[model samples]
Target chain A: MTIPNEISGSINNIRPMSQSANRLMNIVADPEYDCQDIIDVVAMDAVLTAKLLRMVNSVAFGLRVPIDTVARAVPYLGERMIVGVSLGLCASHLYNKPLTGYESEEGALWTHCLRAAIAAREIARYANDKTILDVTYTGGVMHDIGKSVISIYLEGSPRKIVQGADSGKFTDYIEGERQILGTDHCEVGAAVAAHWRLPASLTAVVRHHHEPGNSPQEHRALAYAVHLGEFVAMMGGTGTGADTLMYRIDENYKDYISISAKELELVVFNTGQEYEKIVSAMFDGQETAF
Target chain B: MKTILLGVGDLGVTNKPGEELQAQSLGAGVAVIVADSRTGCIGMDHIALPDSTVSLRRAEEKPGYFADTGIAALLEAMKVFGSNISEGGMIVKLVGGANVMDPNSTFNIGRRNVQAVKEVLWKYGLGPVAEDVGGRVNRTVTVESITGKIRISAPGREAWEL
Candidate 1:
């Protein structure tokens, strides 16, 4: 089925940023913003604050002590994690919805996204490139934002997409999306990142994660990290299914990342443990605004 | 002829003269053959975690159950067809073990599966002569008994022999 160009174009333009996310972004970009200012903003939204605290305390952070409040988490998690948390909080709502054309269920896409972000952070750390941690986290979380738009456009036709996905027609499903919705999720996600004025590295990560060869050199590492992370997520069966397993890993990336097969195994083992804790905590909290 | 097929995990693939089986993602299905001069053994394993290639969640009811499936499949193949193969002339090779699941979850069936295979092989005194296993990518593996050559297939990547 084909979508009209105008409708598809509008679908590409869709961005799911909530009002709270916009405010959080402002706080992150504001030069004079203090911890208290961020805390105050979080406090105003009890659900986001609780989610933030739960995430900070989750095993993903490798925190030794339990964090009771957002105020307490700030100093320990620092500004970068705080930003990641805020972004997580803001984007959680969007992730609650399902992705059309992908077999992921409600929360599956978000879970995969969050895992990729965390994996990206760990990979960056493993590669001794800590500076990109925040960007990687943000990029990983938002990498599939385009899927959100695709989901909306294909709202009533999820079964068709799932059938296509099961039959190894994922590329065809995306092509059908292009025909009916005007654009695919990758381009739409990239547009959302652009609208948010995210870093170029992040935009690239969102845009080309599905096909890493298309990424520019500067963003290639970031793209690879997400690609690897997402693959791990899919294999683990926490996010998508095995439908896309046929994709290749770039051998060239091995040179830059220094990740051997053994190291990759370790990453998966470690990340799986962390994902369990984070998901448990995310669901444990009384409030669920984020 | 009898053949023994070995399947390696991500780490196992890197340490070898064995062919690398590139599956689409981890947890994707893979076929490996181990044989000698006359007989062939076929085995299938699915990755249960996500890494570079594919992603899959552990079966929620029994988190690490799939690990045993890989070993059982191979052993069952050997038991069922053990008597029909050629005498002392046999070759062994390996493939499969993609990390395609949530990296940060509590399940680690992929690593466990790799270890289980190794342990089972050691018990049976059937070591791999050549192998390609592990990584995030899925692999399709085939072994030729006559030449003892193994072929692997991966998407967007070239096929190679080990």
Candidate 2:
């Protein structure tokens, strides 16, 4: 079992500049940057603008009228949502690559991440925690970023580690990673989050989403949001991979969110519909050489 | 010797005087039995996974699709029986919460079924006086009607009282 050099090098060299860079550049490049200015920047990147427009028209928004341009999408999606979508789309490139360890094919993680993000967003909205919705979306998308890095590190050994973890030969998946790859995905993801200087809230979610009990109360809520989101996504069959078993919903955290068991079910039910809308809108309109 | 079989979505209690009783199961399954001087209530529930909690709402919408609501419904029946046999003080014995599904999956409906039972009992203010839950092994539980003794059976394991 050996790590693939190409994957390892790409992961090691991963700088946080992709989406955050674009957002920051737009913000700093124009101190007085408004939604239109942001739209202008997105429009210059035809591919990105088109993706943004498609997202605005997606069923998640349930827009009364069709949105045709980045400028028209601004008010409908709002500035923050546009930024979040852009960030989410930009990060997809990283997860789009193939990995040997998991059951799903290339880009499966990205699809799961996106569904979790959308689910988190809806959960936050339904719970009336608007302030945390964007953060939750970002956090959910990045929560499993560690898995990607870990997969890269264990390119050849993923199967062995997975087998050990499945057999309970290892105490937990993290231990399996340590045995095979020198370090686990959680640690690498935390490092990646830190490197990106994403909000402390999101970084904490990435670090502790897998183990919400250990996280601080503030971060734990975010972790719970992502945890429930992941659970719903997995149950809905969005990411039915070998690692699906590793995704646990911490029952204790149920006390933190306003969502009751019934409400959570409704959110999960709604999430399946939303997932279809977003995937179709995001993917159906685009064609790229992979 | 008197034994009451509690079927799924149903609750039964032994109320007859001077009866030594036990709650027993043949394979991997869950049964909750409560005894009083006048009556004994026993109920059985089966859930898809041991750890995945299903809401009553989900159960109501899909009626028999989930086990949590069935257990809850059984608990309601037990409460009615408990009232009917109020003359006898209630003593509870419980079993079930096995990983009946793919162990590798995180969603364990069996464990969730047990949790749901606990929650329903807690809500009804008649919590399990004693219980067994969660393991690879299957269980058979029995409770005495008069003395309130519980005997649990499993392979290669001696019968134990709770």
Candidate 3:
């Protein structure tokens, strides 16, 4: 498959985010949005409603009893998480499909994405910023969206890409990709986010996750949080591909995060457990909605 | 085969021959302990830090969590398993302890972990026969007691026995 080198040229080449997801994302980001409003929106889409219930019931969330209704499920899955499920479900086709660009197997990227989202939200909570939880989650979930595009447009041996990308000398994985693929996944992911017209925060996070230090000034913290989330996931052995530890970690992170390593260590372990539950619930190799 | 999972600062041993011991995220800060073929028992731990590396004021209760303590615990367990280094038959192998961080970073935890494990092994007078350690990739190691095969693998790479 030939991948277009230019972002504009690749617009029609990849799958686009669903329209309903786009609409719900706007409503979900608003704090004033009522839970019932979300319930109504989801209630309209029977397919999303069903998938949301299935995801909540999956071992990931660990519900005691099956939640059959979107209203009842809406409470269990908060507004932000419900949006995550919706985005996950709507973009399920893109996230679910296997990408050969990275060392991951089928569904590995999807699992890693969910794990990163969970980690990002947990980090935000740890940092005492409960408001940006949803945005951070979205950022974490979509950080590697560009890799999917690169996988399709890949021109040479996957192993060679892994080797070139695995070198720690580069500033970030994208630099290696740019050297090898002309245009890296971060740029592609950012372009995709722009094309989809999702939030600027999401687009910036995608573009600068590998090098969050260089992200837009306003979205720096979100980028850092997403970067940490991805790092934690890699450390936990989820979604760890050939480029596991190749990227640069902001040494000054300790300045940003005051939490002790011991505490973060436990969170890493806990996140791994949560990742297992959520990954199993996510795209199970079957190309169905949920 | 019973698979014993090792989390950070966690350790496990397989007494019976049918058991398989493994650790999924073996990076620079993590180290795996393999059972010597002589005893048909494998003991593994996820050592987060070596006492030799840094002096911590906080009390570390879990022996499996530290390099020195983890090795001490493993040595004690091996004694109970009827494997003596002096008498022979305590062959060993080490996997992981990779410096997955940027090469220039001051915090090369994988090298530190490997150093700590080495010191402990020296104290016990045992050395690893084979090792696949210190790289940028995460490694998974499986010590199968029944077949006496130790499989080392990473993503996109096929498993090879040590």
Candidate 2 lDDT, tens digit per residue, B106-127? 3343455566666755654667
Relative to the real complex, the DockQ score for model 3 comes to: 0.29
Sorted by TM-score (best first), the order is 3, 1, 2
Instruction: Please report, as a residue range, the 10-residue window in candidate 2 chain B with the lowest summed lDDT.
Output: B43-52
Winning model by DockQ: 3
Docking quality (DockQ) for each candidate: 0.12, 0.03, 0.29
Q: Docking quality tier of candidate 2?
A: incorrect
Second chain alone, TM-score for each candidate: 0.52, 0.62, 0.83
How well does candidate 1 reproduce the true complex, by DockQ?
Answer: 0.12
Best candidate, lDDT-wise?
3
lDDT of 2: 0.57
**Candidate 1 fraction of reference contacts recovered:** 0.21
RMSD to native, candidate 3: 5.3
lDDT measured at residue B74 in model 2 versus the true structure, 0 to 100: 48
lDDT of 1 at A271: 66
